[model samples]
Target: MDISTLLAQASSKWPQAAALSEPARDRHLTFRQLDQALTAFGQALERLDVGEGERVALLADAGIDYLIADYGCMANGRVRVPLDPTLSPVELLAQLRDAGAALLLFSPQYADVAEGLRGEGIRCRALEELTVAADVDLPDRPAQPPQSLASLNYTGGTTGVPKAVMHRHASLCAVLQNIVMARGAVLGDVLLNVRPLWPIAAVAVLAHLLSGGQVVLGGRFDSKTFIDQLAQQRVAFSSLVPTQLLRLLRETGSAPADLPLFKSLDIGAAALTGEVLDGAFSLFDGRIAVLYGMTEAPWSCYLAAAQMKALRQSGESAEGVVGRSLFAAALRIDRADANGIGEILLAGPQLMAGYWQQPGLTGEVLVDGWLRSGDLGRLRADGQLEVLGRCKDIIRSGGKSVQPGEVEQALLSHAAVREAYVFGLADVEWGEQVCAAVVLEGGASASVELLVEHCRELLSRYKVPRRLWFIEELPRSHYGKVQKKRLLEVLGVVAS
Candidate 1:
């Protein structure tokens, strides 16, 4: 069944219930109102000649208009390509062109940026202009084939340029089902979402709506505002990347005493370190789940807060503990060595169809229905999974592959070290040399020699960093993954 059909059912079941809201803008929509707006927008798109399977690119920040345009396209049977408005003009244009979008929609704030894309020959429509009067008949919702393309979601571009991941209607429904079951979502739950709506957060929005929950949308991530919303709205659930979590911890110092309504806090899109987890547990008296997945497969594995507490109490390493696969997903380690470390492979109903307009690249990763995650990990004896790091992130020094995550974990184990990023730099003799950049905690101090000695105690000599630099913070992608490319750039070494 089409996702829109499920959404229609939700509106019918909870007509007066809050469906979407932007507190900053003072905009709120009940389920029935949201459905009506979507139908109106769908009618407007139809009048503009937008058709089934057509690509409509949306460049806007998270807001009511964004959600309207997204579901509007879905109701019209058009594939919506949501591009991050924060991206560079060149990057944005490249994706728009790659998707072969038939029309472009932009919010009022992005009118100037939309104008710049006029040269691309695509029809540009202001989001505000795409409206139908209340008296106009609503367009009939189009039938969406299960295998039809739903959205062209771009990857985080941590490894290189982002690829447009193609997700089908059925696949997305499967993902929603997995999240609803795993997260125990139910009617009347309130979800506070501060992340951008282009990719990951969109899934969260769908899961909440599917389970008949209220969604409180925040314009941008302000730690203070986020906390205030939790208390003010009695938000029951939220998702945050590690960077956001750390920032929140820094802002609040500890979880606010009055805000106890928040229930589940999901953290993912980057590795969750022990230090971050420790600080998070101190601040928020809620369940903190560590989720692990990529653009190709979402909600694949999750480590619940109880498991996290158990691991910490057991004094076990939680460096890459991403927990067991979801009930609807299957996970395996491909080409394991004696230590059972291998590339993480995933197969299940929720896996994306493939990358848009890149069959060669799709062929490289999707093999025989399994996605080559490019993430190296090992399944534990108890069925939990530990993601070591990306296969490409392995530092080859003197003929041995040094997992940067292990080195980073060792560095972070130091009492004074707050954060650490490990990578490889070009070395004529060694081919590639292990290098590290570290940030120290407040009132704490550590030297290169001290950190080197610390790693020496935990790692082999070859895995120890040959050089180290102290920095305020490590450069990271929007998703919170450390940008090794940027680190190499800072060191004046061109990454191979």
Candidate 2:
């Protein structure tokens, strides 16, 4: 069945159950109301004379309205182009043109940008206007096929030019199923989602609804508010990136005392450091689950809370252990080295159809049925998957290959370091010198010389950072993944 059918079935089975809520705005929708809203959005599209298979660019923050627009596109056989709100106007405009979006629906907060798009001769309107138009009666059309295009989600472009990953209704459904199974989602459960809806996290939100659970939207992820909302709603399941989880532990000092009903906390987007993992276990009582995947294939590997607790008890470092592949997913280590590290290859029903309008680029990644994940990883003896780093981010210094993650882990082992990012930079003699940017713990200090000595003890000479920069914070994407290429550009080092 298509996404529309899946949602419809959920709405029908639990018509009165809470489907979505935004506590910050005091907005809520029951299953029945949510289904009706989806229909209304479809009607609104019809009023705009937006036909099936046409692209609709959605530019808005994470909220009930954004969800409506996204599902509305899927329900009406329209292609959705969910633009990252963090992107600049130029970047957003480029995506709109690239996707050939028939209409641009934006939130009130983005009215200025929408007006700017209008000036560029693009058809645009405030999201609320669509809601108003949806109030009228409109006939329902036949359901789209499972193979129909559902979304055009853009990559973060950390490695190269960002391309939109195309997904069909079937692929999205598979991901939702994977999330539901991995998170133990159930009827009447509650999920507090603070991450933006434009990203893959939206699928997790949908998974809850499809499982007859309530999804409470926590807008913009304020540490204090997130804790309060969790305690207030008695949330059963939630998800966060590593950065958000770290900030929660630092800012709150401990977990909320009132989370008697909370069940699981899913962490994704980046790897968690050993220190952060310790803090998480101490504060949350070992309810942490680490998820690993990308835009093209969401939630491919899942490390459950039980496994996390086992690792902590055994004193094993979390490091790059992103857990086992989902039951339906297959993992392969391509061109493995002596230690078994290699580029990760994934094959699953959830893999993206391809890059939108870029067949050649898609061909590079999607070979046969396996998607060549640019990530380098290996399977551990314990059956867990250990992701080393990006294939593109490997540093070759003085003809010796150095995994930046390996050096960064050594630096992080030092007590003074709070956060660390290692990369390759240009050098006259080495061709590419290993460099690092570090963030120190509060009230902690360490000179580059001391850190270098510390690394020297743990790493090979070629792997140690030749240069180090101490910064208050590293640049990060909206989802908390470090933007390495952008970091180099900011440091005046040529992008690798």
Candidate that would win on lDDT: 2
**Model 2 per-residue lDDT tens digits across residues 141-257:** 457799999999988562345589999999998898888888887898999888877756677789888888999888888877777788889898888888788788878776534
* lDDT score for residue 121 of model 2: 78
Off by over 4 Å in 1: 131-140, 156-162, 255-257, 313-317
Global fold similarity of model 1 (TM-score):
0.95
Give stretches of model 2 more than 4 Å off: 132-141, 158-162, 255-257
TM-score, candidate 2, is 0.95
lDDT of 1 at 208: 91
- Per-candidate TM-scores read 0.95, 0.95
Worst 10 residues of 2 by lDDT: 132-141
